[model samples]
Target: MNETAVTAASTAPAWLAAARAHANRPTLRMRMPFVVDGEDVGSVETVVMDRIVEHLPGGHRLFFHDAAWHLQSANGNATQAMNTLAQAMRELGLNGPWRNEQLVVCNEDGKRIGMIERGLVRPLAIATCAVHLIGTAPDGRMWVQQRAFNKANNPGMWDTLMGGMVSAADSLEQALERETWEEAGLRIADLQSLRHGGHVDFQQPAEEENNAGYMRERIDWFSAVVPAHIEPANQDGEVERFELWTTAVVHDHLARGEFTPEAALLLADYFGW
Candidate 1:
């Protein structure tokens, strides 16, 4: 191999390490399966469960049984019950930053069970879905965004062109289109060579919540080519700014831990670095 190829081969491990660092799977030894209507939906840390039981409304029917936490007597209104519990938890300061958005809760088989507040997903260790878009300029430079400084999580970190949660009301396709427009001010139909880039599953402690919350997310990422004449403008105010960076510059930022872990994982997988 030539000198450049040798150097590239030597640095590939670092990229893999950076991505793998965010995939720490949770051990359920200290947690209990949160079951709804006889379906196990999530794994809640024991301490978090205790806090929830203590703060949940008196009318709620969440209880521990059969070695799992189960909601009893929801009467087909499990969504409402979960929302009530989530709101109560938030009121008692047991949840993460409240987004006032609802996320679909699903069982292991990906069956939708109910909906809960977005902020309570981590506290309850519920698996959530998100979409990320990776944009490349006509010259092959990647478009990255700086998160708003006041954001609740990973503030000021560089990220993929656009990334946002798949809200309860959106399908994967709808989320892709919506987040692209909201975060980048670019319509999906206007992009070139749009393609699905697979997904990455992340399970880690939510550092923003001081490790009191757990994050289990599946991020479906896509990539597209942005026309040179089109510039990305932030419409949602969640993005501080956007910059087009060469592959080398992105790699440097990844190595320096300047990118959010989720973004780093997707970018590394995209580049096969």
Candidate 2:
């Protein structure tokens, strides 16, 4: 992890500066193709990674065979082979309520290419979409959440008020509404001034060897104002706790490198950096 402090001299918050630094870092390219005995079976995404071989769950292994990175599997059937990989991830305790969430697959241009399980997407290196809701109160304080300790990705890190992948069957609105209610106990009605903020393209090397090999996603960002009277109560167990922080405090954490990379970017974008 790059701990080099994003210089505080800039007008932009330190968190946003750090996010920019992360955005500029180099990535290792990887291919996720389930090849058995030298025959291609299905969809393949070029995964950007920090390393090639990771120690993720299950009995899966990636090896250079026949001049390519082969995700070795016992099952030759394509569906079964993918399942084998998903099962392994579950075993590693990466699976969550969003585990089987089906998300539309896309190329770098955001084209509707196909669909895949959310939990399996990273392992397969497929590009997917997600929503992050930046909630603010009338007091001008922003709301943030601490991710559950068991989360498969960026566990225990600070995150936007709400975040979740846009599943294959869901519209952008539906994914946002669902995640808001589930993660922060906010119904669509509780959120005011709802608007599409923007998007962030994030890719990074996997942190733990037992985690999904690479982290990649296109974040569809949203911002809203919630009633000061309504405190965000988490319905799902994905959040550890919620904190309402002044803008300056957030910048401090970002400078200290405490926020999750994605959340830092989202916060920075929301603040108009």
Q: What is the TM-score of each candidate against the true structure?
A: 0.91, 0.72
- Against the correct fold, how does model 2 do in TM-score? 0.72
- Can you write out model 1's per-residue Cα lDDT over 1-273, one digit (the tens) per residue? 212223344436455674696577555347778887788877777676776776666476878888899875446778888888887777778888888899999989999888998988987789999999989887778899999999988999999999999999999999999999999999988999888978999988776774367789999999889999998999989999999997778889988889998998887667755
- Candidate 1 versus truth, CA RMSD in Å, comes to 3.5
Q: Which candidate is the best by lDDT?
A: 1
Please report, in order, the local distance difference test score of every candidate based on alpha carbons.
0.83, 0.66
lDDT of 2 by residue, 64-120 (tens): 555445555454433444455555546555533246666665545465544446666
RMSD of each: 3.5, 7.5
**Model 1, stretches more than 4 Å misplaced?**
1-11, 27-29
Worst ten in a row by lDDT for model 2: 1-10
Position 10, candidate 2: lDDT: 40
